[model samples]
Target: MNGESKIKINMKAPLKERKFWDVIVIGGGASGMMAAGTAAKRGKSVLLLEKNSTLGKKLLITGGGRCNVTNNKKDTRTLLSEYKGNDKFLFSAFSKFSVEDTLNFFNSRGVKTKEENEGRIFPASNKAEDIFNVLYKYLGESNVTIQSDSPVVSVTKEKEGEYFVVKVKKGETVFAKACVIATGGVARPETGSTGEGFTWLEKLGHTVIAPDLALIPIALKDKWPKKLSGLTLPDIKITTFLDDIKQEVHKGKILFTHVGLTGPTILNMSRDIGELLKYGSVKMEIDLFPHLDHGALRAQLQRLLVEQSNKKLKNVLSILIPGSVVGPLLELASIDGETFAHSVKTEDRKKLVDQMKSIFLSVKGLLSEDKAVVSSGGVELKEVNFKTMESRVVPQLYLIGDVLNVDRPSGGYSLQLCWTTGFVAGSNC
Candidate 1:
């Protein structure tokens, strides 16, 4: 494959005159771009098809445009724990192209990345375009043909053998010896991730998992949370219960939104929230002071009242909670903000302590799938070979990225899956 021979094509090209390709990748997200470039760099005639006007539309907005490339958790076992279900399927892929390999790949391409809190990596320039430019440059130098705005109308396998005929809109069909479906999941439809790949896989005798929202903001049923919108608590613990039974607990930052909660802790627990809602009623308790037990919190409150007898109750509470939440706390405790600390009855003080320790909120539901940061479902993992990212049910057909049923957390694990599986598929295909 050489730049002189490889050329970008459009739908206007005669269908019959289209060059047969060694590999044809559908979608131009992180996985498709990486797969096409990797295959082309290995001397394969690769064709990258993107329905969007440009490649890496979703990648441009990842990590709020900073693009968290990957995480620092280099150990495969520990990293696997961050995922939700069927994560063992990633062992082979992660082993082949670990986080170190990802960093090395980008570093070699001159996209210097820096590590942030929780081992998250971002480009030194803090621009997602820089990351995209690195991949785009690699694809160009490797002579990978790119086709933009050419949405595939249908995909069909030849009557015999391992060849695939990909038909695009306007009656254009291209042939390839191998095909990679990297169209991603239905997380962000605006980014061209409408889960079309799953439909194609299902037609090819593969089981497609029902896609749902993952890493999405949750809506609260109470109006109190809405009034606290834009307020961010640095350290808090959230415990989710289903029908009065504790299900799970997470500790981290929690941000109040117009409708509900959105932050690392809440988003991390959202998948379970969606699942638990089906079984029974879902409720979450927020511990304003997770570091202290109930007894310790009560004792601390008493000490605060003793130390500030002349101060207003609101002033005494302001030391423990943010000022924005002080008024709401007093209201929840059924105490006036202007009441002096010494005048507060023991029962009122106890109410204040209990409210401070555990504030409960009813769970409504999750946002739409398209608004999710990462989708939860796709082609069943058992149907694909993780070692090569090739479909076991349909030979010569591969699946990568969100099109597979691997649910990862927010940080950078999802993109790492794209890089790893895409590279494996490209190298094997």
Candidate 2:
């Protein structure tokens, strides 16, 4: 397949003139690009269609415009663990093109990459365009035909056989022997993932799961969190509870947003928070100083009061917390920041320590799909042949990326799934 001839086609001619193709891939995001290039590289005349004017629009925005190339997790089991309960279903696909393959696929092409905390990989230049350029070049070099801004209206099977007929809105109608549905889920509609693929799959006798927000910021019921918007705490512990019963605790970096809380920690727990919200009210207690006990924190605060007796309470507490957070936090604790540290009552001092130790907040709900990093639902896991990423219900039809109902957390797992599934689909199709 490596020495196969690359298909050359003229742009000026009608795309329908060719009439037939070896493969047709809908959607040109991360998985679509990888799948198209992989199939085309294997001597298939692959046509990649994207509704957007350009390919990889979503890819360019991933990881804040510095695309997370792949997780540095080399071990198959450890890497698959991040996929939640769907790990078992993914073993076969990952065995075909694991995380190491993804890293080598980019690194061998001269894209220098660096590993950040938590084994998250990114381009050394810190630009997502670098990642996109590599894929675009691969597709071009493989002679994969691309038709941008060509929104696919429907994908119907030719009544007689295994070939797929793809109809592009206001464009051309073409046929292919094999079709890969790489259209993503309903996460970021602005980037062309609107769940239209689910409809096409449903029409083809596949059961489509109702999509829900997965990795998204947590919205709060209280207004105090908004005051500290843009404030990022590097290390903190958050304990979640449902109906006054402690559920689980997670520790990670968190960012205060105008609406609520976000960052890696909150994003990772958003799905569980959403599940809790369905049954009962969800409450979260933030532990600003998880490493110290109550007595230890109180002792530290008492020492601070003695040392800064001449200063205002706010100024004294500023030594412990960030200066910007002193006033608002004091307000939340119902303490007078203007009081002199020496005049502070024992009860008031205890109140300050208590608030600092456990800041209470009510979880209103999870943010909507538009704010999500990835949506949860799609074609069910049992419906697809994970080894090949092909639909069991429809022959010659494959699914990849967010199109499958595999839920993964933030920090490189989602993109890794895209790479593995895309490669497997490309190899088998």
Candidate 3:
């Protein structure tokens, strides 16, 4: 579970030594692993190729190392709806490998899961290594052949034999009856999501959507957020606006960064934030205490201040808000932090409450793909058959995971997409 654990993948020999593979999965990511394991389970010889030294590089850091395995929206209608515009296209895939099957597959492997807020399911152990281990173990048990540190250069089908030719960076060539491209889109470059798969797909005549950021952090125009870097505010409501016209309202946890805001709420809204930024400026009003209304918050602050009437305004306000943010926020409201709670003027107190309720900030922009949890573009959905995850343009060629242009929010939806599409592709390819 710690460091680079060795893979006991039970591979017969070096990847190139093999004469032929029934299915070649050109990515050792979540979807690739699933597709490879599923195909091997069906008695097909599967070859899993990875660019990384070890598999699941991105998996280890996902969910801050917790690894949200899947979202618990098991109902077909409800689960599909979370994917936004891709719901209709995904209905067939979900029907083929429902979220329930994902849970059962892991559960059958003895990796128990626990549900957190927003239906995010994580291993009870709270380690991403567990999830990786489960899939790796599945691949090993199914006798999957793995080739790590072997970057695939290109994939082309033989005109005469109809076999897919896979070229490795090391000048090794392998052939397969079918190929599944699970190479993820360009989101986390550190995780090997360089998007070579998109290039391959484009060459194979599949329409690839231009990649963009999704589930990313939003940079703030105000420098004050920089002071509260690493501070996490839970249960806050952020009302979004464009050109002073209200747009969307969201509520969840937000983490302050040196240049921007991140965390669940910001990531879930980042796609929309990116769209709004394309038109004009975006405004965000953060409500520190979303549970309480303006009058109630004022009354609560008044009570807390009365109990510490002799204390400094900053110290008294610490009980209502995060102590680390008191000084920066007080300066924003133009209220002296040294003032006594009892000596604070009614107007100044109102200003302090108003600032707490409506922390106005302008959206500078979204962080680039390096900060994105998942990207929004890849192979177009209309060009693929969801029932089998096969490319309409390329025969015996399938696309899965981030390589497909499915815009899904964070919180296990992305992983579920991987399991669904990979299993569907494995079923047919």
Cα TM-score per model: 0.88, 0.92, 0.95
- lDDT for each residue of candidate 3 in 149-219, tens digit (9 for 90 to 100): 88999999888748899999988899999999999989999999999998888988889999987889889
Ranking by lDDT: 3, 2, 1
- Assess each prediction's global lDDT (C-alpha) against the native: 0.86, 0.88, 0.89
Candidate 3: lDDT of 375? 85
**How much does candidate 3 score in TM-score?**
0.95
- Scored by lDDT, the top model is 3
How far in Å is the alpha carbon of 400 misplaced in model 1? 0.7
Q: Where's the lowest-lDDT run of ten residues in candidate 2?
A: 1-10
Over 4 Å off, model 1: 1-17, 84-88, 124-126, 298-316, 340-347
The residue pairs in collision within model 3 are none
